[model samples]
Target chain A: MAVASDTIAAPEHSAEGRSETIAFLIMTAVLIVAPFFIYPLFLMQALCFALFACAFNLLIGYVGLLSFGHALYFGWASYLAAHAAKVWGFPPELAILTGAATGAVLGLVAGSLAIRRQGIYFAMITLALAQMMFFFALQAKFTGGEDGIQGVPRGKLFGLIDLASNNTMYALVVVIFLACFLLILRIINSPFGEVLKAIRENEPRAISLGYKTDRYKLVAFVLSATLAGVAGGTKAIVFQIASLTDVHWTMSGEVVLMTLVGGLGTVFGPVAGAFVIIAMQNYLNALESWVTVIQGVIFVVCVLLFRRGIVGEIAHLLRIKL
Target chain B: MFEIFGIPSNALFSQLLIGLINGSFYALLSLGLAVIFGMLNIINFTHGAQYMMGAFMAFFLLQYAGLSYWWALIVAPVVVGLFGMIIERTMLQWLYKLDHLYGLLLTFGLALIIEGVFRNYFGSSGLPYAMPDSLRGGQNLGFMFLPNYRAWVVVASLVVCLGTWFVIERTRLGAYLRAATENPTLVRAFGINVPRMITLTYGFGVGLAALAGVMAAPIYNVSPQMGSDLIIVVFAVVVIGGMGSIMGAIVTGFGLGVIEGLTKVFFPEASNTVIFVIMAIVLLIRPAGLFGRTA
Candidate 1:
């Protein structure tokens, strides 16, 4: 499996690598400059969601596993991170790490159960598990029931740099986002990633070739969950609260919508998708359920006519790998 | 009345009854899901929303049309089922060639749209659906008091479930349906309208969900969010049952409901999640599910 992947992936990387680098550079420049003109808080929220969608895409886009209950990881991480910062008085960095750890642990448990069944059953299992967590969260005391963990102190980054100011926090979020983005790119381009793609393309063939596809899928699931946790934790810190809304299935659906709108398997799709969705949510805040309606419409449209999404279409038209 | 397991019999019996009622709905919903999945190869994420629509349809009938519960039992399913058929024809027909996940996503979107639109007009609060006069009273069993309505719900749902089972497993039309499920191309060559059959199958499945919703309206109240909450639990039940056979879906649905009810009595904290816990254990033991054959 390893040898076969190397031969196939090596040539594709050299050609695709240049385009990916350019896209990354362009995205970084946009992140750095856009806050000057737009609201930093919105940017922070959008980036957090972008990271979340990217993590989600790692499973669906690359691994071909559609998890319908990812809000479990993202939302639980937010809760634990908020709890750590508020109740435990941990530093911001440590709290975020705590959240990420929470996601990894939960992902390990849920992924094992979900991967037991393939295809549609996998989605259902994950969703059920996530819903289970949601009920647990509702009953758990530290979550404060419906009120959630509010007024979470965004403590210093390393017990040195004060992150009370929006500018400092935005900068911190951007750095973490960029670092995670690079790590994801690196993972996707690695040998392990090639095996993951192979599993996605043909699990039985990969298994016949001696690849333990389940292990690869489990590892990918955990990685995606951990990154999702980071995104959720960061959002909790930025928003200064983590509520039931984060853990709800709707949040899970929202992430799916973002990834779909961006492009399912494309490198730059989730980021664009996240930004578009967050902007829509921010602007449509006054309309209440209409936002959900609009989101549903977009989902229908994307699936029916625009399955490639914004970035996927662009990449296709230009004959480039996004 | 005698006590069992250190608990009052009345409390235990009452919880058990509630569990049976929940199980009835679970059986109905999961049966619909299984039937639809068999023919359409889609998960029908909008089943819950359609169920909600059925309850709302009943409410609308009572409020505006001066129709009674009896009328609603016949009307709601047809209306909601027609709506589902329209959706299947216009949207779901295109997704037959794609990955099954797309169907799930598309239906999920449809669910959100339906729920959102309902929420926009009705708000999130529950609308009351009155109990019919004939089914309003209760009966005193040897051990516990059973509401006539609750008993009727169990019996009606059981009959419906078994009837569906019989139709699919025994009838000639069901034979055609099963044959189509196995190989649609071959069924089409044999002069059956596979596409129309698929649409009707989807509609029939949706109608069953609506029927459950109609039955559930009096007990749970008609609300937009009702279907979403219940649907996830039904999903867990489906996972446990394996969606392999109709009987499996019905039995698992009722059995899990009873188990959940028992948990509520013995361990209240875990009551809400007992089904999911059961699902996890079932997956560990039989990945294809208890009733499902390994595919």
Candidate 2:
């Protein structure tokens, strides 16, 4: 599968790769200038979600594995970071790192257990595992249960730059988002990423060709989980809170929806999707149930008729990868 | 009261009975999921929402039509089944050629829309569903008293479950369904209406979930969010059972529910998560599941 894709993708691969890079540059530039015109808090929230969706996209896009319970990593990290910052009085960067490390451990344990199943069972297993974490968070006293870890301090970045300034915090969030985004891109384009794709296209074939497919999959899962944790930790710091809402199944569903709405495998599609969905919530807060209905309708529409999504469709029409 | 291991025998019996009742619902719901997944290949994420709709159907029938519980048991499944058929015809059927995950996503959307709309109108608080006169009394068996309605739920669900098993595993109609799903083109070549059968199969599967919902109304409050939470657990049941056989689904559903009940008695804190914990263990030990075939 890898060799076959190489032959087919070789010709268009450069063009697609070039276009993707261009799109990334354009997006980064827009985002850099974005905080100047918009509410920094709202933009920070959107960027956080976008980063989460991108981490989620790495698995489903490159590995063809749909993890239905990703809130475990995201929410768990958010809580951990909240606790670390508020209780330990740790710096923001250190708290975020602590959260991401915990996320990696969680991914290693969960990803190993979940990889035992394939296809539909795989999705269900991840979801069930995440639900277990949700229950833990609910019952565990350190998590603060339903009330969550409120009044979490953002704290100083690197114990140097005070993150109290909206613009300064925005700069940190944007940097984090860009770094994670680029890391995902580099991972997928690397030789390891090719093997991951081959495994996705046909695992037996990849295994037959002497590749340890399971290890690759496990690595991909851990990377996705840790990256999702980073996004969640950043979000908690921005909002200065960590709550049950982040750990809910609906939150997991939201990440999946964003990835789908953007384009599963497309590089920048999740960012677009994250913005679109957050915007919907921000603008249509009054609609209540209708917002949920609309999200559902979008889910249905994306799956049935528009699987390529907004950015994906544009890229497809232009014969370029996003 | 007699004691067993420092616990009262009556308390144990009551929990056992509660387990049996919960098991019945799980069996019915998981059976429906297995049946639909057999033909449609979709996990039917909206199964929970449809189950809620079934309870709502009974609620409305009682409120406006003044129908009895007996009538609801007979009527709700049919109405909800037809609605499912419409969904299959209009939406689900289109995704057969695409990846099955798309169907899951699409049905998830449908579930959200259904649950959200209902929640919008009714609010999250549950509505009361009174026990019918015919099934309200309890039977005293010296050690423990048994609620007639609860017993009836267990019996009815068992009958429906095994009846489905018999039809699918032993009958000619079941053979045709097996043949149709395994190879529709080949089955169609033999002069059968494969498409119609597929549609009806989906309807029948959906009907089973509604039936369970109807059974649950008097036991639990009639609420919109009721099926949503239950459905997630049932999905764990389906995974643990492996969707390879009808009886496997039934067995896993009941067994897990009973285990969950036992957890409630023994370690109340873990009751809510025991099924999922067992699911993870099963995945590690027997990834194909207890009764499931290796995929």
TM-score for the A-chain in each candidate structure: 0.98, 0.97
A1-322: candidate 1 lDDT, tens digit per residue: 4666578867887878888898999999998998899999999999999999999999999999999999999999999999999999999999999999999999999999899899999999999999999999999999999899989999888889999999999999999999999999999988788888888899999999898999999999999999999999999999999999999999999999999999998889999999999999999889867998899899999999999999999999987788
Q: Candidate 1 has which clashing residue pairs, if any?
A: none
Q: Please give, for residues B71-145, the per-residue lDDT of candidate 2 as tens digits.
A: 999899999999999999999999988777888889989999999999999999999988999888999999999
Model 2 residue A237 distance off true place after TM-score fit, in angstroms: 0.8
What lDDT does candidate 2 reach at residue A305? 88
- Highest-scoring model, DockQ: 1
Interface RMSD list for the candidates: 0.8, 0.9
The residue-by-residue lDDT of candidate 2 on A19-58, one tens digit each, is: 9889988998999888878999999999999999999999
Residue B92 of model 2: what lDDT? Answer: 93
> How badly does each model clash, as a count of residue pairs?
0, 0
